[model samples]
Target: MRLALAALLLIPLPALAGDPLTAAEFEAYAQGKTLTYAMGGQVFGTEQYLPNRRVRWAFTQDVCKEGWWYEEAGLICFAYDGENDPQCWKFWQDGARLKAQFEGDPEGTELTEVEQTTKPLSCPGPDVGV
Candidate 1:
């Protein structure tokens, strides 16, 4: 069945899905949208992407950290206020959905976009009281 094996191999598999989105694609899709991210089916965080690559993120809380994203070496990286380290991630788009994989660590976190809306992310802003 050498011919059968060859035929099977020649049969084109369906177009491979889950091709990662390019930097421009990611920015266009994320901008002006508030996306809620989940991991292991539990809500992990939410981010509101604004104009000029700015963002605000909250981890299931009212407080938000101001940040911005930049495309670096085919990955999206974020820098937040008071956080010296920049977190990088790879993003993929499956149809209308977005997926994020943290960089550097082999077992780095994976976040799925569970919900999205045009609503701006709620933020208490900087602490006004001591």
Candidate 2:
């Protein structure tokens, strides 16, 4: 009986109309897109959605980092550390706007897609010098 239950649990679930997007789906949706969003007034973090819309690299405030983002069940997750106890952020997009509920906060901020570049662009213009 235990084995049967386990088998049942392992069954692949279908993607619902409003269900969370899978990593593969997420990638397809976000890959090859450059998005600009504000984090403070200066605006930081230019995200490049790779083949999976995964955060290939994020640069902001003198920091350059890479990480992965995916959806499970019905929640979207962002992991910055890429290891144990990594900082996680959850959000959802409904075609028009994205609603993000951070891990520690009970509520999230809503953001609209202002602009998306066709490809990943370099941070800190050539004159600024990395």
Candidate 3:
């Protein structure tokens, strides 16, 4: 039993997913790209990174929200139009993709990058008439 325990301890553990990305790193990786995110293996939403830290986000096939992100206390916080509270997240780069954890709860929902493209997000007007 003692030898077995020693061998187990000697085994190398797997590395962590990744470290949180800096604001500049996040911008360089996300800017000008539309990225799809998944949570719990299901599509969650999509977001488009625009110039000047502007962003457009929407649920799957839902209306878009115009927002802007800024770094606050080493976290990326987003303020959307008409929204009273800002949503913040810590972003990480996992291999070629990105991951995000809500700042309010570190063990809560985690979002993973599913797809990325240069195509602009389609935001239909709230009211369209014939």
Best by lDDT: 3
**Pick by TM-score: 1 or 3, better one:** 3
Q: What are the per-residue Cα lDDT tens digits for candidate 1 across 1-109?
A: 9999999999888534456667798998999999999999999999999999998888996578888999998899999998999999989876677999998988778
Which residue pairs in model 2 clash with each other?
27-52, 27-53, 31-49
Write down the lDDT of every candidate, Cα atoms only: 0.87, 0.55, 0.89
Per-prediction TM-score, please?
0.81, 0.53, 0.82
Expressed as tens digits, the lDDT of each residue in 1-130 for candidate 3 is 9999999999999546667778998999999999999999999999999999999999997788888999999888999999999999989988889999998874687999999999998888755211
lDDT tens digits by residue: candidate 2, 1-130? 9999999999999644334455555556567787765543445456666554346445555443556676655455666554454444444455654323455555544333455778665645444322
Candidate 2 accuracy as lDDT: 0.55
Instruction: Give the lowest summed-lDDT range of ten residues in model 2.
Output: 121-130
Ranking by lDDT: 3, 1, 2
Off by over 4 Å in 1: 1-16, 125-130
Q: Specify the poorest-scoring 10-residue window by lDDT in model 1.
A: 121-130
